[model samples]
Every structure is written in structure tokens, then in C-alpha cells.
Target: MVPMMMLAAIMSPSAQAQPAAATIESRAREVVALLGGTGDYDATFAPSFRTAVPRARFDAIAAQLQQALGKPTGVAAIEATGPWAAQIRIAYDGGTLNADLTLDPGGSHQIIGLLAKGAEPRGPAAQTLDAVVEQLAAQNGTSVFALARLGDGSPRLEKARNATTPIAIGSAFKLVILAELVRSIEAGERKWSDVVTLDGSALPGGGYAQQPKGTQIALRELAERMISVSDNSATDILLFHLGRAKVEAMLPVVGFTDGGVRNVPFLGALEVFKLKGVDGGALGTRYLAMDAKARRAFLDGPVRDTPIAAIPRDLFQNGKPLRIVELEWFASPNDLIRAMDWLRRHMDGTAGAELRAILSKNPGLPDATKHWRYVGYKGGSEPGVLTMTFLLQAGNGAWYALTAGINDPARDVDTLKFTGLMNRALDLAAPR
Candidate 1:
């Protein structure tokens, strides 16, 4: 819910000290121009904004915006809220939206924050956060989301749907590996620069997978690739070097609190692909049917040695999702929130800056980044599942964590639709 304080207008008729009304208005107009697809980042946005949100990202956002809003006919003159801020009205053909612009006082007065808030007849329907939760849960398949404010004490779950039950989260499990890597580094057991040899079990959709069999890669580079691109090879390599037992041990510390019992004998990316991505999930079914002890032995035996090319490709390409559930790594939205907050607590200042940087590497989708000062994100998906979780820091210095996901056993989850809904939640959940 957007509190009354957030609705506390971003305006000041007279207060002084920052930029002139004319300068603020001009910068605000430049923001509109960028949204209209005619302005460049270096000229209109602050250094920090440019760094946090890249040009290509902004371009993509603008394209999506233009596609939705039609042509940006004009922008109203902005009112200077302070030396560094203003709220402007932006008019589009289909409808209209408002933008809150913030400028930097240090050197060139470029915009640091550009929050585009447009409450359609649709979302932010001037509605509560629960509305979005209900909508997500009401989707075709089982949809879930957990919203919370991160703090020193226990997190207050502001909204939730199926947030306690663990659900399949394809690649987001990489966060577990990342947390374990950080723990190992802090324990002086490993260094980010440590090099490891790569085995030949490569998967589709990863650059590292294309490298030579014995190629050497640094731990830091592997992590970056694993997260930024969802590099299956990089993730497997890290899991191999860190040891499954250690990574599994760190799961509860990061948020799986099940003591790794549920995910016992953790399966690597190669094993997952061999089982779930092939045989119409027959292999996964057989593997998942075993007990923990038997499962471990199975992984150590046939599952580990089976090659990805052992089957005819495209057997499952008819667009049907896999039937395996317990085979993939699983977590609830609240569990992911706990994991994100755990990372945030450990990464204070330089203590965990590099680690935090890894989380902030992609920021996933930019729809939420504009409203928050810091956006650290991780998203996962397969044919039947799509999950996105974020660690957002508001301008008021308050921190928030949220995870939204859709799980359908029969169909391909709609990415764009889920993303639009998730972005709406961010817009409404954020402070104005």
C-alpha cells in the first residue's frame, strides 16, 4: 500500500538552495524526452543513474513504454520540490502518466531518479497491495508472491500467497550457491580469485559451456557469469568446487531453514538437465521416487555419468511443461525474501560490497529499479515456472524484499504478463 506519507506531495512552491525552477523543469523535460526516445543518458541522467541503468536497458524500457503509451505528446512544466527534485506531468496518447524527477547537486545537474507513476484504470487501481497478490494467485496456474519490509528484527510480511510452501525455482537456486561462496570466502577457506578447472559437462545457453574442457576460470568470474547470464556451466563448476555438502550446509543460514534436508544430495545443473530436460521427465520421475540415501547413490552413479545427448532432441518441444516437481530446487516467496534480507544484513559497507555487487549485477528487469535507490534481483524460470525476487532500498532509507512467481504444470507461463503485474506491484508498493 502507498501510505499517506508517500502521497505527501513532491512539491515546494518556494523552498530554496538546489536548482532553479527553470533548471529543474528543463531536466524534467529531458526525462520526458528520454521516455519519448529522443534523449541520451549521458546528457539527461546523472552518473549514478547511467551506471545503475544502462543505455540499452533504458532504450528497452522506452520502447516498452512507447508501445504501451503511444506517442508522448508533451510534458508539463515541473514544480521545484527542493534544489534537487520536482514532479512533472507527462501526457501520452492512450492516457496520461506522472513522473517524479530527482537531480544531482554534485557537478552537472543530471537526473538521478526518474520514477514514472501512472495509475491506469488497471493496476495501482488506487488499490491495496493485496489486490496484486490476489491477482497473481488468481492466474491460470498456481501463482504466489511474498512482500515484506526488511529490518533488524523479524521481517513483517506485508502480503503473501502460498509464500510458505516451497515451489520450483529453476535458476534462482544460484543464490544458494552464491551465499555459500560468500561464507567460504569469509571463513578464509576460499578466495574470489581462486581458479578452478572446468569439467566437460556443459549445458545449453551459457558462454562458459562453449569453452574448452580443461579451461580455467576464476571464482569471481564464474559467479558473475552464473548470475548475469544464468550460466549453467559456471554454476555447476562453483557447486563442484565448493562441495555440495558445504553449499547445502549454508542453505539454512541463507534461508532454506529446512537444514538442507528437503534438498538433500543437491543436484548440479548437468544432472538436472539430464533428468528434467529429457526423457519427457521419465528420468526425473525415477530419480525423485527414491529416498534420500538412494537418491544420493543414484546421483553419484548413473545420473552423474549420463550425457545430455543420450536422447532424441525435441521430444518435449511440443510446448508441454515437464511433469517433475521435486527434482528441481524449490523455495517459497518468503524463503527468497529471507535469503535476500540475509544477504543484505551480511553485506554492510565493504564487508560484503563485492558480494552485493554480484546481486546487483543485472537487477533483472528495470521496471522496479526506477522507484528504488538500489535494486538487487534474481529471477528464475523453466517451461512451467517463472519467479522473480527483488531486494529494493527506498529513498526513505527503508528496505523491502519481494518475490513473485507462477507455477503451472500444463502450460508455458507468460513472461510479459507476469512481468507487467510484478512491475505494477512495485509501483504501488513503493513510496511516491
Candidate 2:
């Protein structure tokens, strides 16, 4: 988790200074009421608003808001900034919601914009830890280590089911690189503004592929891209700069030393594809047999420029005769949360702020703010593996680390099922 000192205070609308229209608050309340009562809510929208958000989409957003915040009780506060713009706080059966609503320009009361602001309550969570554990057990071949604490205190709920065992964590391993960079910055070794040159590497996604070579990007930008979008080339650049030894040493530095997760010769996106493309499915055996130096030689030698296009698509599916356990980066749920704790404890000033800002850039789910005062999340997914980890702060100023991973060598872990489950777990663990 990024340190609290790094996060900037979220700005609220000025209440007393701005002059508000007489009907502004009532208009906002009417909009909420129309959503609850239904009929053709789209009829209230301006032409542009209707074009941007169709009736079905508007209906979906309304349903989600109701599910997340419950029935709208009343408007608690309102600050109209313009003839159309108004900031409001609404009370609901679930909790209080902060929103910004804009009425259409002209004479129509059509809603131009309706955005939920700040954090709202997720109603009440499950009372007992057993209920959460039961849900975890229901999913086969899944492991989770979830512990929520109150402002750096002891865990309120710490439950581990096969949590000590390590599994392939996909992009979640990027956190290690982030942690190492912070350590370097704090030690006077590197500055966040330091710039580095980019060499050619065929990264997996379109995120970084379009950038020209010799781009002379700063370290901070690279780190942000790596974490926020899981940019492959950005990660490889950092990996090459840090070298294999420093990354390997990170396992023990962050307290992941119980042999649950291995530390040496980390794989970049290209290298991962190379391993998956090996003939006769012997990639894991071939790579595991070599020492760190030999592995480095192979990575640079044959697979250095391996492009994403070269790898077979079927190789990614479940039961493809590949050894994901040995081939990919591994970490247990417990190991990840421990590292999150370390990051939280060490975050300071600019470096911490950079990481926190990057984390908050994730286009979040609609109900995300309802449960957390703030959330820093990074998720990793592939064919047979899925992981979601969060560093959270509650409305009452408590902190939490909630992590879950699902693996199925037999088939792909259902993405929606696991994601929904983890979302519920996060809501359940929110500070009361």
C-alpha cells in the first residue's frame, strides 16, 4: 500500500462561496427519485446526453447505483456551482452518496452529467469470518490469504486456506519491481526523475509498442506505465536496469523466504512467451535445469527479440501440457500481502505519491468507492490463473490488505466468478 502521506486530499465542492440556483437542489433530488420510480428516465436527458449514454446504459447505471447504495432516502447537502452544475450528498438505505449532477443548458431539465463522487458505504458486510471462508472453500483449487487491519493494528479477519503454497501470480509480480525502485530512491541511489533510454523489445500488448526507440523516458513514467496498464516493455526496461540479482534478492528483502516463492531469474513478457512456445512442451524443464547465468544467456541469446505474434494461441489455454508452476513467477497470497505491508510502512514523500497516483488510475468498478475510502488495486490474469490484490483504507481511517488467487490447470478459472467473489470479500472486510 502507498503511504497515507503520499495521497493528496480529495477536493470537495465549495458550499458557502458559490451562489446556487433556487431549483438546483430540488432538481438533483428529482433525478434520484426518477431513477427509483422508473418510467422513461432517458426522456429527462438532453439530446447530447441521450446520445452519449443511451437508455439501456442509463438504466444499468441506475440499477447498479441502487444495488450498491440502496434506495435514495433524501438529499443531505447540495452546492450548486453553476446554473447547471451541482454537488450533492444523498442519504440512502445503504449509506450516504456524494454526487455531481449537471442539468441541460437551455430550458430543459435534462441531465447532462451524473457522476458519483467520493466514497459511499456498502451497506453492512457479513458478520462472521466463517461465511467468507465457506465461499472460498466452495471454489476448488483456489487459495486466499485475507487480513484486514485497523490503522496498522492487528488483523480483524485473517483466514488462510492453503495460503502458504505459491502459485503463478502473472503480472502481480510487478509489485516487486516497484518495491525495489522505492528502496533505491530512499537509499539515494536513483531519482524518480531519472531518464533512461529504451531499446527494442517486442512487448506483449499495444500499450508500449507504438513508442519509438531511443525514447529517453523517465524512470517515474516507466514505473507508472508498468503498474497502471501492466505495460510489458516498460517492465522489461526496469528489469534490465535493475538486473537479475537485485530482483532475486527482493524475495528475502520483503519476507518471502520460506521457499514458497523462488527468487532467481525473473521472466519478462517476451521470455514468458518464449517459454510457452518451446517445442514439445519442454520449456520448464529446459529453463529450470540452467543456473541464473545460463538462463540470462538464453534470454539474451535466442529469445531476446521474441515477438508476441510468434507464440501459438492454444498454448495459453488450460491443460496445454505446459508447466505454469515452474515456468512463471510464483507467490502465495500471504507473501503478496506481507509485501504490501512492507510497501505501506516504507512509503514516503514523492516516491509514495507516484505509486499511489498510478494505482488510482485503474478505471474502477461502479461500486468500488462504496466500500473504501481509498483503494489501490493491481490484478493479474491469464488463461488458467487470476489474482486480485488490494491495499485499502476504510472511511474510519483503518487499513487493510485483501488478496485472492485462483488457479486451475484443468481449465480457465471463471473470471467473473472469481472477480465477483473477491469484490464481495473486500466489501465484507471493510471497516465497520
Candidate 3:
């Protein structure tokens, strides 16, 4: 789980531009072939890698893995970092292992680095919170985790790791959006059935964005989609309706105390898409330099008119996760716990019930629902960010909140592996 750094021999800085799709594909094929003992080491690995781990040693290692994990299968996935490096998922008969793969940044595109890491641990690893934190801290650029029991007052921390440090939470910030909408409803300022129009910006699956621009939909449905599927278009509409200033204010009230200064003039989902999509992400490079005022001006001025079609066809595929750590939503695992507690405490009337339904619609971790009387979950991810938060009511009606987030900022973190770790954390925090 350590933050991956390329071997010093080719420690070249990555261009913000994306790596070519063909390069990723070819490198993946070569690595798998090499693992299977069918490809030549000299051809598959660069001289730097071969020099550090000799051809004989690499062959022996590959043989050892085959003995332990069975045959080397195809590359399951590749998460590219900028224009040079990628984290590759290699499938095997028993399970999977990850490879930190890098190509020479020089025009040659030679395989400059290759380091194979162990497959994810089974249920045997991380028996305690301290153990879990060790694993988490080792795995990402910054990892924040919090587990708390909720009561009438503040949440009680059972275990926490850098719980107050802000890290990008990706779409998990939709929780705040949901929170703000619920708060407004409780204050009689809004209603679940209130209608809003769609702007039809594209989202990853067909969202309201695919519908006609003039089409109207209920706020409840929008919130449901935003949380249940992490629907970006739906989130943008709600953010627009609520206004950024209002959502920004809701941050600390829910849990994130520094949201205003950290994320001034808040951003919508489409706005982020545009920022990362235009001019090969040159706009983001410029946008990153500004203060709150300048950023607001830039986003509103030229950035506003950036076309929807301007978003890359491979927006998430082979794309560098540009400026996500700085440009996206920021929250701590502690903040998420308090946010979940706030939503739990709000459940006294219709607004409360609606909030529960929206948050519970997905359960993010569906199998765990059997362990609690009630389970409401919302999670989020991008290329290099993964965050999950859960609100649970135990069989004894005791309430608890569990959250974990990993921000790599270099390559994508493995979703299955992180979820496995969080699953263990939940079992420890609230055993069946």
C-alpha cells in the first residue's frame, strides 16, 4: 500500500498530458507475457530494471509466484499516472497482484521500471485498529480513517488515523450536498418534490444529463441518483440549485470545519469535468495557481463556456488525474463521522426519513446490511481517490459511524483491496 515512486534511474517528472492508450496496452501485454515465462526479460523490461533485478532473478521470482498463485493471467486493469507511469492489476489463478509499471519518459517509451507487489491479504491481516492504520498509511500518499459510535451528543471515536487532516474525498462530498438539501428541507426552505431542470451535461452512465434540457425532476430523485450511483450530472444540478455558498457553509455545520477556506466558491461536477477536460488540462494548471478570487473569476470567465463535447472520450481512461488533490472536495474521516451523525440525529420527521432513504438507497457495501438493523452508506472514488462512510444502527439499536479514505495522487488505488480493508475495519468496530 505504499505510495508508489518510480525507480530513480528514470525518476523523470510526468507530463500532465495523458499516456497513450497503445503504450499502456502494449506494456500490459508484455508484462503478463514475461510473468507467464513466455516473453524475454530484455525485451519486456528496460535495462535499468533488468540491471537491478537480473534476468535470472526475475525468472526465479516469476516461477515462485506461479508456484504460489498458479498461472499468470491477463492484466486486469491499468491506472496510468500522467504520461509515463501506471499501476497495473495482474490476474492469476488464485487471486491478483499489482505491478508498479513505468515507461521511459523519453520518446522511446521503454519499460523503465517494474516492481511486483504481493496480492491483497486475506481475512488474516490487520487484526486491530493499529494494525489497520499501519496498512493504510503504508498504502497511499495520505490515508485517513475514523470509526465512531454515535450517541445524543458528539461522536465517540473508537479509532482514528489523521482523522482531522483534509484530503480530497472525490464524489463522497455528495454527502454534504445531500446534507445541505436535507437541512434546507428541515428549515422549510425546500421540499423533496420541488422540481429542478436538467442542464444535460454528460455523466458516466446515462444520467439526467442524457435527458432533454427542459425536462423537470424532483429533488429527492436527484439526491437519490447522486448518492446511489454517484451520478455527477445529478449532483451538479443540486449544487447549482442550492448555490455553492450555501453548500460551502453546510460543510463545517456537517463536519468539515475548513471547507470554506479549503474549497472557497465551491465547484460543481461539470465545472470539475471542464477544468480537467479543456486544453489537455492546461486550464487546470492555470486554475491551480489562483487564490479563491482568481479561481472564481477564471472558472466563471472562460472556463464556463468550455463545451460539454470538449470532455475527452477517455476522460477516466488513460487520463492523468490532474489536480484532483487540490481541485476536488476535501474532508477528513472525522468530518465524515460527524456528518453521518448529523444525518442520523436529523431523523425525527419527514425530512429525516427522506434523508435516510436517500443515503441508504445504495448501501455501498450491500452484504454488510445483514449485520445491522439499519445501514446507510455513501462512498466515492476517482482514479487515485477512494472514500467510504457508513451510518449503522446495530441489532441493539446502538448507532455507529465508520469511514476510511485513501488518496494516492499518483495512480489509482485498487478498489477491491481498499474495500477489503474497510470491510475488516467495520467487522472490528461492530462485530456481528
Alpha carbon deviation, residue 305, candidate 2 (Å): 5.7
Question: Candidate 2, residues 1-432: lDDT per residue as tens digits?
Answer: 000001112233354223235456656667668657655565665665564455655565566557766787778788764555666777878766666666654455566666544335554444555666666667766656566563454344466666667877878888888888888887788998998776765665424555777878888988887876567767878877877568777877775654343656677766786777766445545777888788878777766654555666445532232556667778876777777777776656547877677666652333455789877767776666777778787898777777778776766554434554565677677767
RMSD of 2: 9.5
Q: Which scores greater on TM-score, model 1 or model 3?
A: 3
Which candidate tops TM-score?
Answer: 3
What would the TM-scores of all predictions be? Answer: 0.70, 0.67, 0.71
Model 3 clash count equals: 2
List ranges where model 1 is wrong by over 4 Å.
1-127, 201-205, 258-260, 315-317, 349-351
Of 1 and 2, the candidate ahead on lDDT is 1
Candidate models: Cα lDDT each: 0.72, 0.65, 0.74
Q: Which tens-of-lDDT digit does each residue in 1-432 have in candidate 3?
A: 211123323443444344455676688888789889888667766665554466665676677567656787798888764466666888888767666677766555767666553364323667887887788888857888888989988999988888888788888888888889998998899999999976654443325656887899899988988887677778888887898889888887887774447767677887787787777888787888888889889877777767777877556544235677777888777888888898898887669878888888666552456577788988877778888889998888899999988888787675655766776676666756
Local lDDT at 24 for model 3: 63
| Residues 75-111 of candidate 1: C-alpha lDDT, one tens digit per residue | 7446554566666766677545555666665567667
Better of 2 and 3 by TM-score: 3
